[model samples]
Target: MNFKYVSYLWDEAKAKSLGNNQVDLLIYRSNLLGADLRLTNYGGGNTSCKTTEKHPLTNEPTEVMWVKGSGGDLGTLKKSGLAALYMDRLLDLKKIYRGLQYEDEMVELFNHCIYDLNSKAPSIDTPLHAFLPFKHIDHLHPDAVIAIAASKDGKAINQELFEGKLGWVDWQRPGFDLGLKLADCLAQNPDIKGIILGQHGLFTWGDEAYSSYLNTLEVIEKASEYLASNEGKRRPVFGGVKIQALEKEQRLTQASKLAPILRGLCSSYQQMVGHFTDDERVLQFVNSNDLDKLAPLGTSCPDHFLRTKIRPLVLELAPDEDITDYKKIKEKLIPAFEEYRKGYTAYYEQCKHPNSPKIRDTNPVVILWKGVGMFTFAKDKQTARVASEFYINAINVMRGAEAISEYISLALQEAFNIEYWLLEEAKLQRMPKEKPLSRKVALITGSAGGIGKAIAKKFVQEGACVVLCDNDADRLKGAEEEFEKTYGKDSFSSNVVDVTDNQSIAKLYQTACLAFGGVDIIVNSAGISISRTIEETKESEWDLMYDILVKGQFLISQQGVEILRKQGLGGDIVNIVSKNALVSGPNNAGYGSAKAAQLHLSRLLAAELGKDKIRVNSVNPDAVIADSKIWAGAWAEGRAKAYGVTVEELPKFYASRTLLNEIILPEDIANGVFACVGGLLNKSTGNVINVDGGLAAAFVR
Candidate 1:
């Protein structure tokens, strides 16, 4: 509504493109609209432009409609993302179409009408945009407009609010039929500036791109102002006893325990990854007394049904229930998810048509658990985040609508039609193959920095949801933010955990379960080395060594196996041992002995857990100097002095000592870890992989 369109940005977009100027303009406008979350969130809205260009083969002028393509977010849309359709060819199909019973035929017609054979698939709403008369059209589900449109008296309120400026179309499932209805509505009201699809969204168009964009903003701003004036003073209050507010750490601790249980309950044929949020706004709704009554009303808009389904599954915890009690939490979670599944099946059966696509998995995308918090689940992290964002926005809009009047969403049949629409089904089918670790979760200790961080990055890149654990709270926070920015907020989470403590190690497993359901891969990379002779070493120093190097591995791995066994899914554990474990040096008695014991522990666990298909392996690296916290400052200076060189030359000296004469990096060690945990060495467990640029002494027979 603020209309922050800067002229220079538009100029820059135009200046870069010589051909396909229309697409360039469309991308520019789409980005502007998408930049404002109020206008659209994630992949919710679409834009299109009409243009005439010469066909590449025929050299004849052809009318083309370039519309936003599927799977591409408008905020980062590129010219290639716009599907170019031959307008004359598409409009001609309306004449030849015998009454089509199934929507699949209509989708086929649209696909055949594409002017560029290689263009990305057009959006499902392409028919609606094509049927409209204007040269440019913009459609968005703005929260403000939805607040007005979803009100109990939505149609009447829209009519009153816009006066005669906008036309109204009753809720129709988005397909050819709805597209035809939209065209009919516009034809009936020739002078209207826009069309408001009841409980759906807003559509505006003009001869120029800017006009359509501006009209959308103006209409949304007006609706926002109208709502503010009428209902701004009221605050929604639920009748529940406000539980004593817990501190942030306590809330997170509770969430960690509750998350895994709910995650396990939600898992189906395909694993479901969970992402939790105690976000202030989300908490306000989940904690509200009216949650059971209000949360079931349904999605704010129709397109949302594609991702979030009709409504969230609300799990009501007992007022006095202790969330930290894992056993009690499990008792509550199982029944709640099962009940939700049954209700979903009933809903699907009631509304499904004979030709409707197969029912989507019954697992709910959004879950509102009492006392704990809200969670969103998906096949991968990015999608989970998107679903979460939409639901949060829906909560705000529904709250606004309720303040004005009882909020109402579309009928179940309408939502079902959109959810099972063949176009969306086809879009899902057309998605590229998933990465190797697509739905798997990996937990890496010492991930706040060093080799652990590198392993975490690699796992995330390969499409695994990563849970990063480290003892350094400050570094953990920084790592969490960095990974979230690069891989998306849902892909990675960081927890401050001291591996030497059993409780802390248990918390790490809980965090992984809560953050990503349960773990399939565990990497024990947290370690320390003490440079002391056997005669000089204190008893405390030896205790510290064994606690971190031996006992820590046992505790974390033990907890990880428990969660993995619950999941009944095979898992991998990669321990970061050292070359010293295989070949000891003077003054390395404590560190070397501890690491050797850890190596044997890995072998024993592999032998014990092989029946469960849990693989345990170790990677022994000699002197990885770069990006290693263990080798920083005094340690590096001391090693350099021992090698008769400065710190800069120490790396070269160590590399020369190796058979391969190559300096080993953290990434090199991570690659070895990856081989063990990434199923590359699935059949070769209880083995030591030397990642020391081939140190002869450390070679395993």
Candidate 2:
């Protein structure tokens, strides 16, 4: 809760902006507050500053409030992310506003108050910030503050803790009405430094940005200290025999078995990626004896309702039974999800208004599996990660609140109002157009490096939930970290699997099914290259080549077909063959024979699985030496000797050999893979599309 405001960072921001003090200071302070997870999570808080800017065409000075716009995280917020709304226009709405009847209309009026036409829509809470009289305002749902704000006796306790420095506003859904109520409270108590919104969040403001940010820190710190002092005395303790902690290996094994089943049930009809976490804190909370009492008490704050529903769906488990048993896990997960869905439907019916938007999908955003930790579902990785973080924070807040008194969240009606509010729903409607492969789950083998990694990256960009499989565990871990950073932790996951083994291939498919419901596309990209003549090729060399290049494709594609059949959805399987499959090169009998066999296997599978609507295709790529693990050691030396060139000159020689004289890169191969999987050739399968930069020998007939 300590203020981390650095003067040099603020000075540097102002210097970089050429003396736009308001915006630079706002950005600096927003980042400082956002950097602390205790204060606010990613995109959970907002900061605003009042400034005057001249109208572009009219050249008249107009007062504007630059508030944090929707979809921008305060942690990395920039000037452009703060939408400029005409302060006078927003204030004018208050005069004409009637009662709380026209919530949707009020949101529209706020949108119309924008001073800068090109800026994104202002945050839904813009009116709340505007209604305040301070020049700078900060709002955050800090855990410590929410702990005090969400207690059963929150008002009385806050009155005592904060004294006269803070005012309390009863839980009111965010809208024009709530803004007016907040404004009235502040007006009545002009000496109050901040206001605590019951079951929502905390708001602090000052004439300057630093003061507002620091005031928030100060208030939250005080609340945190209050909770610390009352913890042992007031915290509720449940009496039950403590469950023995499972070994790490045992826990992971059980989780791996149940993760897919839970994932499949949650994503039944919808496309969602489930991010699993077994962190010690999550395990401690889920395994607590008091979980049945505390887990379903509701979200820590209203804002979190948008990410995690009002209540998490907690699955029951037997204490002494084996949790890793698939049948046992499946039996518990399926019925639990069904019951949770029915409950959500009933809850929606009870709380929804006549004009409210259609109910959201019944799938729970946060799932508390019996023996497993938490599993958060989202359309993408970053969102899932954000939800997981928020839920973890909520757990802490609820624990703290229980320490003081009973934890009490807003009533169900208020939660529904926030969840289905026009402003909140608009965020989803405002998302950019989805790509062709959006929400589809894709499994890519050999994803540790080379063309497989490139394919994984492309699928992620197209909005596919990707599963990366490789035999090299270390490389797979590295790829997972790299992709998680680039695409998001939810977008792709890495699994170690030897594609040559049937069991390994089956496990890979199961991982994909659990991680992202089921697979929509499978790219068999794992292979090895051996340049040896028929006379010189040893039996071991030949067998190894066939095991990886030919048999591996057969195993993975077969398993993928089974998963697709179960889902009753047509899918695509693209094999990464090579130009050597069609046009045999000198001293490449071992490699060429295996690839040629793989190409034929793809055609055979296509002919058989097409009845199930499973399309099979192959991309024959040539000499993609860059980052190719297959092109190292003996393969590199042999290829250079075959071309009568040095190792360094091999790439140039291969490029010159092509009719287009182009050097094929891994991304070029990935493009061909995307073409096959993205429905470009939906009706045409059992085809080999050459990605060899126009090699006539490798052209399809």
Candidate 3:
């Protein structure tokens, strides 16, 4: 239980050698203890350290809390590789937890802590660091300890193993309260070597990094040994079948494809590691006539719905036996997946509150065929390793535990409570909602205007592979040049589209969806306006305007919603309506009426799609400075001449009408569109935001 065992980790951190990223420390340590902690089958645990820096001249220091951004493992932590945050801001958030219940507080506080802040919110254990007095912290739910925790009398077993040695806390949610509980317990037990969270995981720390780490392992080993000696010997359940070797290359290929989706399902998979083995237990289990019955027991834990879902994939081919090649394997597997998903959805619908975020996917992470050993998926090799280690250890432990007593999982509703519990969902939302528009190919009809180009640029900035469309080829080419110059080459495409034509809109949406996996977001910022008072307006003029403005908007929103709702993302549709819709400015009947109609359309869609979490928002600008072809052509110069002002003055003329007295740029409107994604407005639907630099006309109820 001394620091001697992990001094190397301390040395690495001291020398600034772990990595330039925050997770470097955790990743490094996880790797070091992989075999012992099984924290990572290959490399799983992730760690981060936070520090603040001051601006030299202002002397008004900006506090930055750097965290591992996206990648790395806890076994290692370093500098230069973390996302930066304002420390004071995070510290202030600790106040929100004061009187709120743990469950309620977790969601609000977690969202606030990570909300659009510089870094990903610290791990679920971040509140622990905030609560602890130590400068270094380590969190690992190692397989060895989980082996003990998952047992029938886990709490009793832990009490016996660490009597008067380690601090203990009943499992609470993992963030701040968990931290608070551990901190309080540790305070009472000053001489405690470490702490073990009941039924969840382990925590260890010391004044020095190495000492804290080794203490974690020493305790786990103690638990492992205690369990081994106390449990009576039992017959091998795995003795039923003969063992055979599994093929490495073939399994690896299959594992690779499943790993990404699996890893996305569970944070545990980040430390994935692989070993080709034909252990008798695994072989016997796979070859058993009742293999299907045993399949569900192999998941790392019952709570892995976030990553591995609830079901397990069955592989019939043994590792050593020759495999049958068939594309229909996936085809056949799809139905089973559908069945699993239906069960999950029904379970959630039965138990969840009206507003709970719906279950999005029910895909399994591990494939255990009758013959093939098992395949685990993860975000990286380290994640895969972690999932494998946890699952493998659990399977072994559960088998033994079943001999002692029956094993039952928490109810599906209970699992759902834990899964969609606000705190966890807050974390999911706090991380930049996956760039909605990024991966989806999009078709922007009016590509040559300020709003259209702004939305297009927004998608491109988020890494979406884009397809740009406009009626004029030359103007499309010009918009493409500006877009590429701004976003980098090949990120956008030019397509000639007559958006009023239904055939064209359908083709464009299909093209974009197929090209980019699936269309996630669509911005219908294309429209036309002819200013005429009621007396001056004509039937033909109104028809043409409706064909593009009202009709085009209707077509795009309808098509976009259909694709999005079907995909289960409930995708986003951003309409560029005029501020005149809110406060009509003595405009022509066609423009004003069409804009008003579109506003109601957006509102109706919002109400209908709320169930799907498909968000619909409108960005209504007072008057934008156009960079699109609409402005570059005859319209801009004509408007300028009519106003007796130069084209440059047109922007300022619009700027003066706003209360803010600030000029609105394309980027300003761009910000409005960007804010519509995942953050700032998870609950916002069918809302219109004014990007008018303080214009009162765009204000809406």
Kindly list the per-residue Cα lDDT of model 1 for residues 140-181, writing each as its tens digit.
888878887788888788888888789888876666777788
Which model, 2 or 3, shows the larger TM-score? 2
**Model 2 misplaced stretches (Cα beyond 4 Å):** 1-20, 52-62, 235-245, 319-332, 467-491, 494-520, 551-572, 583-585, 600-616, 632-637, 640-663, 680-687, 693-701
Ranking by TM-score: 2, 1, 3
Worst 10 residues of 1 by lDDT: 1-10
lDDT of 3 by residue, 1-701 (tens): 24322222335545277454434554454446544434533223444445435644576756444444333444443443344445565667656666435535553454454422445434555566656565456666565565555555666656676886777776555556666788798889888776766545577765444555666667766665554554444444533455444465454443333322222222221222222223455556666543555555433343343444445566444343321222333344456556655665686788898768766544445556555455554322233334544556555544534433333333456566667876567666755644544334455667665667777777677656566877767877888788768875546646677778877776666444322323556677777767655776778988988888878888877766655543444457777787867775653567778889888888887888888788888888766765654456544565566457788787887778789888777778777877886356877888888888776656785
The model with the greater lDDT, 1 or 2, is 2
* Model 2: per-residue Cα lDDT over 567-682, one tens digit each: 55678999999888889689988899888898999999999988988899999999999888888768999888887899999889999988999999999999999998886788
Instruction: State the TM-score for model 2.
Output: 0.87
Taken over the whole model, the C-alpha lDDT of each candidate is 0.79, 0.80, 0.57
Better of 1 and 3 by TM-score: 1
lDDT of 3 at 45: 44
lDDT leader: 2
Where is model 1 more than 4 Å wrong at Cα?
1-22, 57-62, 100-102, 116-118, 232-250, 353-357, 469-489, 495-520, 532-548, 551-570, 603-615, 632-663, 680-687, 693-701
Clash totals for all models, in order? 0, 2, 56
